[model samples]
Target: MEQKLKLWFTEHQTEDYGITFRVNHVYESEQTEFQRLEMVETDEFGTMLLLDGMVMTTDRDEFVYHEMVAHVPLFTHPNPKSVLVVGGGDGGVIREVLKHPSVEKAVLVEIDGKVIEYSKKYLPNIAGGLDDARVEVIVGDGFMHIAEAVNEYDVIMVDSTEPVGPAVNLFTKGFYSGISKALKEDGIFVAQSDNPWFTPELIRDVQRDVKEIFPITKLYIANVPTYPSGLWTFTIGSKKHDPLAVAPERFHEIETKYYTPELHTAAFALPKFVKDLTI
Candidate 1:
């Protein structure tokens, strides 16, 4: 008898190249009003989540993304009492937010309610904070939510997907302006600006747009294995705070896997080519 060739789960990250993983099992797959959601068990990544055929996060490497997204902006601000998250339905960002004692409340606005339901069930470790008392889960449009808010939140995280479907507006200058209006005078914000390797223009546009709206703007990098190109970029904008000037004492302590006090300042040190995009 001959051994069989195991099937693989592949994501076409771009027209030229794609990534694949050995699929142990597919927990579930379904299409919601917004996008396709999938939970799968993989040999390399253990439990993995996918949205619209894109690799959202995997159990093993999720720490890199969640920690970077949360800590950079949270640490940038001296005190972040109230925080709002846009499109982070998986609850990973919320979990990181609750680690800060200064965060009195974390409001998560996800358009697809099913993403929250399934994430809580399938990705428990990542989504555990959704049930926390300090987290407010709202099923609605993040764009509209940002528009209605006025000087409310101290820190805002835009954990959105690629510029498609519901996330297209999130990458626009108008939406960045809305975030400025929604935040308090000293508020800070960080958004995943896609990968510099493939989407350098997008990163450039986001940095330019954010610079126009916020007094302080900077770009940082994080390596996420599951995301496109492995090298991911985050753009941080602040009304009054500068992530570079954060004092050594400002970073007290936090339980994080990928982020640290030293890395906080180092992440902003971008490669020459990636830095050229911002210039």
Candidate 2:
């Protein structure tokens, strides 16, 4: 029998349980000024990016998270010409934003520049849109960007990491208020609220905070396998538009791998447990 190497990269999603991916190769690992960044090629999920030992995204299933975050609010607004993306250094959100012809300018603010640099080299397909002519990449703090912005963007997407380290402020009530001020009168915003299975309190707290800020607040979900528990939640806050009330004429056929016109409204149909969190 030929000798075989048994190497696996495991993410301790929680203290009790974890997910392990068989490792084919480990490309780069380092501790940036912000967090631990690692790039690995896995036997299962293809190229994998881990931030602070947590699975961020994999080549196999990035479309679901990126599409849901970018499209739902974009479609809800009548015209989203100016958009801001906070902490999506991987550029997946920016890629989806550019898909809409109505977007004239897309601004990306990432506090950690290392995430963008590595993603551009290791995950080009997802990060390529950061270099697009319409995209203006800013390397700085996203929280301050939200505070300084005054009725500037038509849409804002918070593509942040889990609530830890640099992302802690992204989930606070003050940030949500700043987001409301940052948006135009009819603008909308969306933020990944994490998986309900592991963090039900997070979902509940985020929903409560967002509801206090935006006139239209809704919680939706998407199945992202790499994320903890594979059930990810997103909280959408809108000033003058409701995602559930979008007309068919408002939706145009766009090139997408996961999101569709039919699935748009269907995503908002939450289960009883998740629905209770919104209460």
Candidate 3:
């Protein structure tokens, strides 16, 4: 007799609700100094990365998140030469950031070396840009890096997890203040602000904090199926440029599956309910 067993991985997004995926195989499962890291093969998502029992990135829909997070601000800035990416160990944001010809140097500061090490092995397509000559990977505390750097980056991207564990400080007002000092006078920065459905307060609080620091601040949305609520929000804070007012000439041809020239402004068109959170 031959018997088959089905394995499933469930991310308990909240105490009451969560999402589950049918697992075909488990590639890597271990606890690093920071968090629990797991790489699993799923029928729907190809390969899935989980940190602390939450979806981080997947093979199928990563482009949507990575592209929106990178392009929205890159296009907003007139000429971003040096950029800093804090907490995106998967290298997905870095991959998208390099698409712009204006970016000459991209530094990635991630706290966990394990996330970077295993992502390269299990998620090559997403992590490919980490090895590029323009990228300098630093396996250290991103919070401290921002505290030390002064007027260093033309653009900064905070591709971090939800406000938990190591990422808690990233969402604080003090960090936003540090980011203001870390950026060039006219630098632009964007951060994944989690979904408005589960964390409306987070969205509201981020908006309020960022608005105090940057003259131009906006909220944008993207649909990433594997993420919580299937709806994700990113908060952009800029000293000079405005993402919505990007000129037509600023947009150039780029290879992307999700982000487009038209969608750059369109993504900021939030639903009524989601828009309420930003106010």
Q: How accurate is candidate 3 locally (lDDT)?
A: 0.95
How high is the CA lDDT of each candidate model?
A: 0.92, 0.94, 0.95
The C-alpha stretches of model 1 lying farther than 4 A from their native spots are 1-5
Better of 1 and 3 by TM-score: 3
Q: Give the TM-score of candidate 2.
A: 0.98
Predicted candidate 2 versus true structure: per-residue lDDT over 1-279, tens digit per residue:
954347888899889999998887788899999999999998679898899999988999999999999999999999999999999999999999999999999999999999999999999999999999999999999999999999999999999999999999999999999999999999999999998888999999999999999989999999999899999999999999999999999999889998998899999999999899999
lDDT of 1: 0.92
In the range 106-165, model 3's lDDT, one tens digit per residue, is 999999999999999999999999999999999999999999999999999999999999
Cα lDDT for residue 9, candidate 3: 82
* Residue lDDT tens for model 1, 54-79: 99888999999999999999988899
Error of 2 at 229 (Å): 0.7
RMSD of each: 1.5, 1.1, 1.2
TM-score of each: 0.97, 0.98, 0.98
lDDT of 2 at 134: 100
